[model samples]
Target: MTRQNVSIVLIVVLGALLLAVPALAAALGNPALVGLATRVLIYAIAAASLNLVLGYGGMVSFGHAAFLGVGGYVVGILFHHFRFSEPLFGVIAGSDQLLVVLPAAVLITGILAAGIGALALRTSGVQFIMITLAFAQMLYFFFIALKTYGGDDGLVIRRRSALFDLDMRDDRTFFYVVLGFAVTFFAIYATVIRSRFGLLLGAIRQNESRVAAVGIAPYRYKLAAFVISGMGAGLAGALLANYQRFVSPDMLHWTKSGELMMMVILGGAGTLFGPLFGAAALISLETYLTQWTERWMLILGPVLILIVLFMRGGIAGLIDQLLRRLK
Candidate 1:
């Protein structure tokens, strides 16, 4: 089958599965599973953002989680101290209007990312990775040192951000909100990858010197991709904080960044939907395994090792290969 035909089939199957989830959850009466799925979707968005940089732009950042934390903290600080009443510089804080907050989060993250990416892209290889990681650690410690808003203990969001009188505190409402953002971001990502800039970014990823020779500045393209990636992560963070009604320093940790990378790798890094699949599988496994036994990491470690050894392209790649064989 043609790639377009395959994509259509995949979309149909995925849409059916998503639509069936709530019904299945209701039938099983497993609120936990429903919650887990929601969490998976949120993280999937974050991981997909990471893929834009690491998988598409060939930028291996070890501090992408910093953007997530930054976005979450922006919401938290605005709500906590601003009395959850007034806006920043006359705009109301905790507006919770996804339309308002989502764009704000993306713009904020994009600015931060542009600054960081400009500096980090000056170096490559381990240096680039280490610099990004170091910056992320700095942000993590900064949050830890901020005595206000619970510091290391974290800050609680007393209420969900308001969204047109929508009861965001309702689990089902929150779940749909997250799902909507994930879908929207994924759509945006798809468009980006097909755009002229995305083509240049892909060229830079494959051959920087060649792209430069063709008059395209590799650094500029890469930085742009990095900023877009950060914006996606930031949006995910905003949704996450609303979902949990809390924000913490751990969200900025290097380990969380690594986990995002792992999710992309496990899902088939370069493929559009790989990160989502990877996040769902990994989070689902972690949730189920932890419930089944305390030593969940023990099992997870070996499984990951095996996947790396035997499935280099990840689950998405494997499925694609299988489909090709059937054809």
Candidate 2:
């Protein structure tokens, strides 16, 4: 078979395995395994969103996790107020419905990203990174001081958001819900990266001056990409909050942004499926390694460094080279 055919087959097989995870875990009576798989999918979504800017648009944002936290807080805050029969901002009523909460999360995060990107895109390189980080830290502190939603203690959810009467409390059902969203996000990411907009964003990444010389506005394109990326991360955060039934200030911490970037790089920055692979690899390593020792990060640190030094493009890149050699 040709290399392309082989890859298609491999992807099909991988999809089948991922789809079977919840069932397999259920059969083995391992809820934790199911939960872990769900977490991986959620993180994959977040990393893929980050990849849109970091990998393709050449925007190094260290505050991407701010969206994640924002999304989670949207759900948490809404639910908290709903539980207490309170109205948000004395205008909008709280909701426990996924339909309402999810879109709100995405919308709010997208707006926040647009505002931040407007300013951050004016600068380049380290300045862009620092500005993004500063914005994210400011959001983090704001959440911590909100006190109404448990503040530093975080918010606890007593029930999952209503999903048209689906039994979201069941682990298997929740896994499927998360998996569906992950697939949808991947589809959207693929479409975005292949579209004309994606091409322009990529060209800007390669040479903003050249793109601008052609009458294209690089700032506008980059800002749109940034907003879309934030929306994706926000959706993932909402799913994560639903999955864990909790939201905390830590979700917006700078380190979480680092983790999302690490996943994108570890998988293969520009590749479509890179974030998924990266999340699986990193999370699996953490899960298995921690069982052996508490210093799993020490081992993971070296592994990441070695991959950067030797792998060049990461796992996806390594696989591509092997396929090329075989062809």
- How do the residues 100-122 of candidate 1 rate in per-residue lDDT, one tens digit apiece? 66677778988999999999999
Best by lDDT: 2
Give lDDT: candidate 2, residue 5: 99
Whole-model lDDT, model 2: 0.92
Name every residue pair that clashes in candidate 2.
none
The TM-score of predicted model 1 comes to 0.94
Candidate 2 residues 47-137, lDDT tens each? 9999999999999999999999999999999998899888988888999999999999999999988999999989999999999999999
Model 2 collision count:
0
Q: What is the lDDT of residue 53 in candidate 2?
A: 96
TM-score of each: 0.94, 0.97
lDDT of 1 at 135: 91
